[model samples]
Target: MAHDAAYHWPPELMALLTDTIPLLCRSKDDVVDFLRGAGTSEALLGQFRQQLAVDRGAVSKYRIAREVLRQLNEQGDQGLGVRRALLRRVTEFEDFSTCWPDDQLKARGLVGQIRQVVGVKDSFTRMQQERDREHEARLADRRAAEEERRRRSALYSDLRAQLTALFPMEDPHKRGLELESLLNRFFALDGIGVRESFTLRLEDGEAAEQIDGVVELDGQTYLVEVKWWAKPLDINPVSRHMTRLMTRADVSGLMISASGYSAPAVAECERFLALKVMVLGELRELVLLLEREESLADWLRQKTRNAKLDRRPHTLLGVDF
Candidate 1:
């Protein structure tokens, strides 16, 4: 049956069954035979047979019909299937062969009513299917969101640990290289496109320029430079990056400094901000962002916006501590 096991037939169906079954079957034997063919068990048939024996054909058919329906109702959905099948059989009947000649007209009237019952059953089945589908969709979305949350949490923990370890390293050169790798992974975690350290070779196969890394953000591409010097960066390194940016009109520049920039270096970047899109970031800000589990891309984009609108290349994010 399309309905639940706990489903109770409404009074309309109960009344319909009361009128329809007895009219369709002339005697107790006829009723037993019809139910048997419709898959009712022998035990139930024996119970009904015992009831008919008590009445000995003296009981009203209406009483007999109700008794039969009561037994089927107790059987749950299994009983429901047989009851619905009998109703459908009434609608499909070509003739009133089972009905008495006098009751045939009344029996014919029931086909339309039976169709309404079937219509309600079909509608209820469709509603249940739609509810099940919606529940499954919600579960799928929740699973995906939870999986993404766990993935980002693990990546944040790894990056934070790696950054902490680098501050204690004695060799600045090796520390800078590891910093480049860590930054690339950080950008990748935010779904940004990243290219690791690459060198531009001259025509004679000698290295002309060694770019620390490259990344694409918000539709603009940038050549990245990484520095972890003991002293602050001077104007010369910033000037060289400006020269590189000048060579490619389509490309921008970003410099990440562990020790920050000198006054002249900041001035040089500010001066060049009018000519190209350049953004300077302090490594400490990145550390703070990671400690708070903030977005590196969003922080950099804010710096880029500051450079574009305010012509300030080295802008520090206001950290609470």
Candidate 2:
């Protein structure tokens, strides 16, 4: 009995025929022989017979050929030859020139392209995560370093304040000499020293001139004059003082004032001693040195205790609270 025309094969089975016609059948005669002997269902056979009767241009052939090659590349040639030969028989009259429409082909190609884009996006996301972690680590390191520097600066400032309070100066000469001594102690220099009330007498029947203090630093002797005046002093006297000190070979001179020096005095001192004369701010920087000594904290505590005792009033003997 002939197969009924109303019965059709499943769409998925029909799609299989469309994908396998290309690489197997070489000629129309080969396709006819393949269909007659294949174990296809009666309904599919009838559809194949009818499709073979139509003009080949009305069916898609090149799409079937390309689809077959793509499947072979993807799935390997595992017993696919028989299916290829059956599809060729159903579309024996179809030419490669009359294939599916361009839109249908483009739609099929989009799936693979979308998968490639998703892979690229995933790689970019992973790289960004790594960079973010590295940036955070660097920020953490910078914060730690800044905190350490602040700690060091605070420690230095505290030491300077303590030294400034220790040496209170009433006279300019006494103040400058004491300041020079403090500087020497802070630096811990051996031969480089500071002495107050240094008396000098010239061999040419000269009257004795007492220098406030003499500092020997770096193999050079410096005669320093100190003043604690409320107002600035004239530079001419300092210049003259420096001149006398300079005449004593290998001697330099500096003048320090708590109220600061007059502009003319500063300029004149600079002219005589050049770079040897330096104006140091009274802001003591002794903390840097104190921090290095292990016994400084104990020493400061003792001094504070002594100061407190001295400030207290003497009690009557054997008096009870």
Candidate 3:
């Protein structure tokens, strides 16, 4: 019957029991007002006032509160039935024991006596339990959010340092090679597992072009092309790379151009957008992605999809801060 004791009564009923009853029980009109607020019909309000009058004749406001608490608890089990509507109107006033004069409460000890008989402490305990659960839930959410923030911040610090090392180059050709090697190290640190100088065999018993690098992600391999050229890339090199993409099965390409591409080169790539084999990006973009702590592979996948959707290989998405 412990479960039977719980009642999710209306806010008016709860407010009446907690705030208006003890202090207002002296007046039939005050109780009537509370009954109306709790959705009580006109018929029961008169009878409920009669019961309070009978109870009050013996003691008064404090004496009637004990029976009021019982009917409220019984509401969970539907014990009150039609009369429950009347009890619903029956409410209590806050600070009743303290606010009421001793004469109105019947006696100085009656407030404590009413609490003992009606088990009001049980309701208080349940309220405290609700507060405790809500407080703990809030704390758990804060802890999880903090943990995610710390993990993300730590990963960004390490990767940003690696990307920063690629800048302020003294030689363009050497920088391109360094960038290629840096990608291998970066992917390795990223836990994507890097393969250097990846090559495939052709039917003529000849080795395919010595590709710069390959990254194996989720059981698929991607050929990587890194270029730190001082000048904008043209269509010739981009076309050559597209030719290399046809030599494999279920394989895609990631082309990193530090200086970006020329207009003709971008147009040529857009022509090959249907192939769904390439994701074009710049060194500055990659560095910014690292600074933002976003997933590099996901970013590449999004750019690849964008090319397929809009046929604009050079378009970049804006990142929100």
The most accurate candidate by lDDT is: 1
Stretches of candidate 1 above 4 Å error?
A: 1-7, 50-61, 77-98, 318-321
Q: What lDDT score is found at residue 186 in candidate 1?
A: 95
Clashing pairs in 2: 56-93, 56-94, 172-226, 172-227, 172-228, 173-226, 235-265
Tell me the spans in candidate 3 whose CA falls farther than 4 Å from its real position: 1-138, 169-207, 215-221, 319-321
Q: What is candidate 2's local distance difference test score?
A: 0.47
Candidates' RMSD to native: 3.4, 21.2, 14.8
Error of 3 at 50 (Å): 52
Give all TM-scores, in the order shown: 0.86, 0.32, 0.49
Each model's lDDT comes to: 0.83, 0.47, 0.64
lDDT of 3 by residue, 1-321 (tens): 133335644443444444435554446455455546655445544555776557645434433444454454555655355335544233222345443475445432344443443356458778999999999999999999999788767867876775676677677777667777766766665578688866667999698676888887767677788877779888887887888887777787778887889988888887777775566777777777667776766666677667767676675644332
Q: Candidate 3 at residue 184, lDDT?
A: 75
Compared to the true structure, candidate 3 yields what TM-score? 0.49
Candidate 2 lDDT, 4-35, residue by residue in tens: 33222223344444343422344333343345
Tens digit per residue, CA lDDT, model 1, 1-321:
344455466667778877877777777678777667777678767866776678665666777677767777767766778867766666676678768998888877876677678688779878999998999999999999999888898899999999999989998888989999999999999888999999999999999999999999999999999989888999999899889999986899999998999999999888887789898988999988888788888987888999999998888885532
